[model samples]
Target: MKLQPSAVGIVVADMAASLAFYRSLGLAVPDEPAPHVEVPFGALRLLLDTEETVASFDPSFTPPTGEGRVGLALECDSPADVDTAYERLVGEGYRGHLAPFDAVWGQRYASVLDPDGVGVDLFAASS
Candidate 1:
């Protein structure tokens, strides 16, 4: 079976807040749709959805309770970008999960949470 990923959907508690956060990161809402925004990350696109919309799939699905429950990892072009992105998230009112640091796997990384409390990791391979 050939498997291809078209999108990654994030169930957000507040669509407006989530959209604003993503837009602050330079993602653009597609012209075709009035509300949804699309952030292209290489081969995949990140799709943000409201709680009500996500409940349509599974009524029992709920937002993560605490830290590190759901994470979205994004690769950066350079280690500096990881630091920059992390700082930007913090400046925009996102709580930092961890400060930017060199990972055991040789990548520089940091994490932040979205409006829905979903974790987002920014990383770049160490040279």
Candidate 2:
């Protein structure tokens, strides 16, 4: 059998904070409390699990640090939207990783870190 890529799993320390971050970015996540939550991320599913949940299954599970963590890029409607999203998130006390700027890639890009320090990028076509 062949393997299919379906979801991206992130072990978050704060469920509410993580869910709020995504909801702010226009995702439709429910306002419920649970150790595990699944979000419909476009064609793929974004799976969220608390640290305790993972530890229950694997005793040796420990959260990763610094670089090489899961990073996601969200596409916006326009370059201006990227800036708006970046500002809105930062204004709401989210950690801004990279300010909005026009990249050489022909897209306006910005980045913010979730409560767990996961980097989430925002981008849109430069007009």
Question: For residue 82, what is the lDDT in candidate 1?
Answer: 94
TM-score of each: 0.79, 0.95
Q: Candidate 1's residue-wise lDDT over 12-112, tens digit each?
A: 67767777777766666443432345668558888766667767787797754665566788888999999999998899898888899999999999988
Positional deviation of residue 40's Cα in model 1 after best superposition, in angstroms: 3.1
**Candidate 2 ranges with C-alpha deviation above 4 Å:** none
User: What number of clashing residue pairs does each candidate have, in the order they appear?
Assistant: 0, 0
TM-score of predicted structure 1: 0.79
- Residue-by-residue lDDT tens digits, candidate 2, 1-127: 9998999999988898889988998898989858999999999999999989999999999877673488999999999999999999999999999999999989999999988889999999999
Model 1: ten consecutive residues of lowest lDDT: 29-38
Displacement of the residue 125 alpha carbon in candidate 2, Å: 1.1
- For model 2, what is the alpha-carbon lDDT of residue 51? 89
